[model samples]
Target: MPAPVLLPPTSYDYVTVHKVQGTTITAASDILAAEEPLEIRLGFGPTGQREHRTLAITMRTPGHDFELAAGFLLTEGIISRRQELHGILYCPDVEKVEERENVVRAELASTVPVALPRLERHFYTSSSCGVCGKTSIEAVQAAACPVLPTDGPYVAAELLHQLPERLRAQQELFEQTGGLHAAALFSPEGELLLLREDVGRHNALDKVIGAALLQEWLPLHQHVLLVSGRVSFELVQKAAVAGIAVLAAVGAPSSLAVQAAHNFGLTVCGFLRQGRYNVYSHPWRIVGAATAGL
Candidate 1:
């Protein structure tokens, strides 16, 4: 196994001034940079077998790299849970550091092929745009998974309205650079369970899901997920795979996300700010909210 190459952090230079003895004096500056890369690699092989097959590569910030890999595999329907991942390691055969590039290969327990569509919509070098590789809206419809419901949980208006702030407060990267997106999970009681942040919104969700998988908490059927960005079809898809019943977004959801939620019987809420939000699907879960006024 090859050692993980961690990238450095991003930083910015700043200066401060002081006024003493009726005179102004100024200090200096600093340098800042963050760890970021595109990890690329292939799928599973025999236990002692090591044949490299081209899987997928994604450009991302470097912390929790393993989680990123596992999450990518799970969300793509490649593997269902953390147990499916036998091992994840860099290709040690390559000699030169440059050869490593942004590649990371994951080995699964089985020799099965991932069942996702052949379309390349999910692969991307960046997250500025959400799920940019699909062929058509109808294609998404075809892959639209069935929703499973257990019990309907009601969320209070005050708690539903305050999720954005709680999610925002947990985003350390956003607080510093103001450039990242975040995703969080909360119990039905509105207790914050876990949170993740990334340069991309989808990646943020993946990291959170990946963490949950590592913890053996899949099919988040009883949990509520919140996103710092808008809700998209892909985000809804990810939520569905995690079995999350409710998805709240700080921004508005696209038409496709709404449709996906409707088809899957998910609870989708957007524009979650200023004590207001719009429910796109399964509105019954969000009880006692002043939704009519919105």
Candidate 2:
């Protein structure tokens, strides 16, 4: 007989609760998505003269902290390439043992420049929203994320319909907790490639992008990114920064999110469930559709 395998401590927590369904009351153990504050610090400047700074603190589910940090930096325009990051590790000197895993330090190569003033404007981020403290839409545009290529990687409308089901199947943590959001990457052929889950929608996407970055699979120009929630301006910005051409969500897209997707030349698909979906921008990427009305 094999011993029961346990999930990572930071991924989820179990609580004994009373369940009242209709009229009956039953005590049961419920799993909850774990959310914790992660402080991201940066080490940049020339080799011996390197400087350290606290970049941003975010509340996120703790499983893939390194990927989350790398993705956050890439999407935030802090570091463009994986080579720019020398290494990512947990902070060694912490006041408490528990705090050690909550802090991550990303050391940047000497060639990479650190803009303290620019990075300081948006220092604190919450799990609910990534762009809460952003100054303006103009500031996001100023990040200079390149527009996606217009050529192929077209996906069928039928394939889009099947994505939600495939994504749901692979959501291991979500199945247990039902409280975490997910971000999944699929090939143009609709094959599920990678998936990440987190308490924050943006954090989930960041983890996916971060894992892709660390694996040297970036500039994901030919893939589709699907999120288990509504599309937001921040998600659009992050997708565009990662060079992902297609961004789909299970829910609706905010007006600003659609506008941003249009500006970035990234295709936006929303209301992605059942047998149909709405194409918010760059409809040409989705094949097998009737566009005669347009």
Candidate 3:
């Protein structure tokens, strides 16, 4: 394989639309989030005899695709570290010119083992659903996701309060189309480190994690992760797998998400806005929280 080419895909597209308000219709241009299927392929086996397999196909906005592929593989337990990956590149032999950028191939080092049967459940994923394609509950718990350490990255309530506004301000695509979800990485002191956007919340986080992994920043035990929307079990699982200490969201968290967070010893904060938020589990990580009664 040749050196991977970085082709920037358009994240949004403009279309002519009729604006109707109070029965008055006017033609105007509207921006919409671009959703397309990204095919993630893996090349594994040995140096002399490598095998290619289609790993997954996800519906996501077309940008930062390389990061998305790397992140997906990491969260899915395909490759645990950046060293396991040989390279990630667009498929050079795509059948169509327009589809060249739609496919990404992740080359894995021969030293890495391949387990295709365990990952069959992830054949197809949509923008709206992350883990719905799961075949069994056992499969979901089988990944080698670690339990987070109890050490302190102790974040202040005041610092947490300011994160949503900071995350919102950096969401360039969301500001334009209002149809994209975002995932951001923040320091314990509330500094915005990195942000990724996509039609699917999972993909956005994958891109963020992928970038971190590529940049050799795994085991994010001292960092914070914030998502734009409600928290799901898949999101919790991903955050934990990446070794994120605190997972915050602008909206509420699901019951399973809270349970998983508690089990993994991760700090979960939901409804994080308006100078207040709910700490669902492991409140001890939040500085000045009274953990005596609970």
Candidate 4:
């Protein structure tokens, strides 16, 4: 057995004394979120043959760390299914633990090398939005994913407005400091299923996806994924990998995110507040809502 890797302490700052309305007032703040460097390490073999490699570094909350790594591998197109993972463990080196305890390595059971180049379209925290440069519309078309095949049930407008509050209520870490992002899964009836919070928005999404994969509930094309922040291309790609058809966010969706959703035949909605939301991609699935007939 290897030694457990201990991550550094994390806290979010939410209290601030600021002048408001010409008076200094103590207020709840959101800037003091926990930020920690988490390193994902790759591990292989059972004992003496074990090998390790530093995969990617990400800033995120410390909880559910294993799920985050698994999700990252999936979205990167390195491993599509949960069964591919041989084992995930903390590094055994004592010196390595002190210097890089946050580091985690994954070992694939198969001998086939996972190609990172195929993941050029995948976005990690360290990669810029458009680092791949411009591609001809046709070239972009070639990389597009097809629409999800599933029968979607109708969701109501009031249910859409209630999701943010539901997700907020479950964010244990965020409630303490108000500095983390959350990703949640909801049934067609707007019931909350699972929610994960992380310092990095992408990490949160990955955790939720990883959880879904472990439960064999993947290809979530029938359910909905809700985020507490704006939608990004990276988020869209993760959703696409899980076959999630509907992605709703509390903020805005980037141009590339919207394009990615449309390319994948997903329904992208943003600015979900006060019973109103803007649908960016396919809207036909949201039946019975005021915007459904439109």
Candidate 5:
């Protein structure tokens, strides 16, 4: 069989590091979450008339890069469905072997137009709150996908309490380096579906979403998304675009994150630990939550 195209060589799995104590010195190795810059390119239009363009370069931990690129496109409102993509390939150029694994090219349908200018502005754009350029409530609405209702999929309070442990158990990289962030997808019954880790929290979210897109599992209304860190408006926006109903974070939620969750009708749960956690917005989906605590 031919070489598997998507499975590029991993750069670093573990590295050697030194440890020190007050009066003793020991040598040991540490697992590092490898950080690298990945360039995402888009190939649009049909055969013989395709236009290829550079999209963005993001710093991310290696692995699941193709998924990261795909998920990034989908959550950014670039491509909606799996069919919109024709293929994803490592840069086929023989001359650039050094970056052959670092670069990924997304082959989009000819009918699709690459929204580089808008995406460029959005990718580089930073906002104190809300999504890229989604400054006001109206602007957020205009830029986002249609809000998925927060009804149905009643997640038990007990299940919410266990999500952090479940998500952390599957974090292979975090257990090693204690440096990377993870985004995990779980079913309503609290089963782990997928977990992605990266140095960048947003990249981890993108990686998980990309995995879902590849599996044709968009519109995750019946599922829950858990991130390793605090909730941000961008994370909320990504989950909203993917139609995820419940978003849980081990850390707290930013003010705009709660606002975005509230505006989009998503259930935002934060500070999730053994017993105590806070519900920031749309508590309806968390069943029996009010009976337990405020």
Candidate 6:
């Protein structure tokens, strides 16, 4: 059978809608954040013996498909170092010229190994939640991901409150459709390193991490990850895999997310809006957190 052809993502769609104010109704055009399936495939094996196999299909806002594929692979423990990856490319079959660029084939270094059985087990992830219906922390930890480092780069309470606003300002897609998730990576000095938006919060984050990985920025021990919405276990797990020190969310976090953060030594903060936020774990990273708790 022929391999599946992945197509490029459509970031948004234009459609007509009705607007009602008081008692009057009017028709108008509106924009929507585009959502589409992105199939991630891994290409591995000896030179002429290399082959392509589907890894996972996720719904994400179109654009940055390659970064998303790379990030997903990294967080999934499939590939770690940028050196381990050769390149993520679009299929170049002259016969399939009309194919959408959504399908990405990640070619790993010939020296890098491929674990087919383990890779297949994680192909069922969705855009909504990385750990949907997942039983325990162990289920998420099956990736053999490393623990996050707990050192310097302690952020200030003032900065933590400012992250949501910083992330919000960079949300270009959300500004247009008011319907997209954003994930941003920030330096300890509160500098925005990368920002990515997606229909799924998890996918948005994957793009951010993928971008960093593509640039050989793994083991982000001095970095902070800010998401536009609530944090989930999957998000924390992904951060841990990348060695992020801090994970902050604009909204609340799930119990599992808190536990994951606590377990992995990641500082998880949530409800990060209106100049107030809660530190779920590793409160020491936030300046004066102990004083705040008192």
Candidate 1, 232: how far from true, in Å? 1.3
Candidate 4 clashes between residue pairs 3 or more apart in a chain or in different chains: 12-32, 13-32, 14-29, 41-104, 41-105, 42-105, 42-106, 43-106
Candidate achieving the largest TM-score: 2
User: Candidate 2 on 151-194: residue-level lDDT in tens?
Assistant: 96699888999899988887878889999899999999888888
> For model 2, what is the error of residue 15's alpha carbon versus the real structure, in angstroms, after optimal superposition?
0.3
lDDT of 3 at 15: 97
Q: How close is candidate 6 to the true structure, as a TM-score?
A: 0.90
Task: Score residue 180 of candidate 5 by CA lDDT.
Answer: 85
- Whole-model lDDT, candidate 1? 0.69
At residue 228, give the lDDT of candidate 5: 88
Task: Judge candidate 3 against the unseen true structure and give its global Cα lDDT, from 0 to 1.
Answer: 0.85
Across 1-294, the per-residue lDDT of candidate 6 in tens digits comes to 122123233677899999999999999999998876777778899899997887888877788888898888888878878888999887664245444576788999998888788677768765454544445467556665666665666988787877777777767678889999888888877888788888888888888889888888777888989998898888888888888889888889988888777777889888888777888998888885446346
Q: lDDT per residue, candidate 4, 129-201, as tens digits? A: 3332124222333432334765664566567788888777777677666677889989978778888888778
Residue 281, model 1, lDDT? 86
Clashes of each: 13, 0, 0, 8, 1, 10
Best candidate, lDDT: 2
List the candidate numbers ranked by TM-score, top first: 2, 3, 6, 5, 4, 1
Could you tell me which 10 consecutive residues in candidate 2 have the lowest summed lDDT? 1-10
The reply for model 1, stretches above 4 Å from the true place, is 1-35, 47-50, 93-102, 114-146, 290-294
Model 5, residue 277: C-alpha shift (Å): 0.6
Question: Which sections of candidate 2 miss by over 4 Å?
Answer: 1-7, 126-138, 291-294
TM-score per candidate: 0.78, 0.93, 0.91, 0.79, 0.89, 0.90
Worst 10 residues of 6 by lDDT: 1-10
lDDT of 5 by residue, 143-262 (tens): 647568645678998888988887777666677678888898888889888888888899989998999999998778889999989998888888888889899998999887788888
- For residues 109-161, could you state the per-residue lDDT of candidate 1 as single tens digits? 76545533431444543333444334433444445333557466567757887
